[model samples]
Target: MKMRIVPIGDQATLGDHRHYPGARLLLVCSLCGWDKAYRAERVIDRLRELKSGGHATRLEQVARRVAWNCPGCGRVKWRCHFAWPPGFDDREAKRLANLYRN
Candidate 1:
């Protein structure tokens, strides 16, 4: 399966294949931080790791909730930039992207 990596300025959001079905193998996006590339499953693994470490990131952020982050203060506050999913609105994701690309 081809990796489906949603592009971002620094990191790409990973879509889970094993959990979400029809998932790609490796998500290749220069925006994807930490590593040059990332596997969808691997992203989940790391998120879970941090969760176990008491630095849990929300699933929405894990699912690409937001792209813009306050880099200056983020390092000190953990995943403070992440926002909670307001509700079911796939279009919101698109709107967010539209706002970003423009």
Candidate 2:
């Protein structure tokens, strides 16, 4: 399923995806087929820096200029997505058992 990542405000106001437990920030580089999932909280930290002293909270704007330093294939540009589906990963399994439950 396609996930939606909506960044609504600054780190202090919007907080991190950690509040969602299993949520992760997925970075995919079409150029090299690089697909990696990083803790959303940590990814937000880096994104805060990439904000480049701007007050804008639009993630797409900030991410447009961000680049990932791919150790396997040197520096590469990547697109970001948020994922918090059920069965995300071992690290988040226990906490996200009720991910989609009503």
Which is the leading candidate under lDDT? 2
Tell me the whole-model lDDT of each prediction, alpha carbons only.
0.35, 0.52
Give me the displacement of residue 18 in model 1, in angstroms. 1.9
TM-score of each: 0.26, 0.46
lDDT of 1 by residue, 1-102 (tens): 222332223332333232322223331122323212334455567767766311233333543433444344332111211122225245755666576567
The segments of candidate 2 whose C-alpha lies over 4 angstroms from its true place after superposition are 1-21, 47-56, 68-75, 89-102
Model 2 agreement with the true structure over 18-87: per-residue lDDT tens digits: 3455656666664675666766556556657766533223434434656557665676666655555543
Any idea what lDDT model 2 has? 0.52
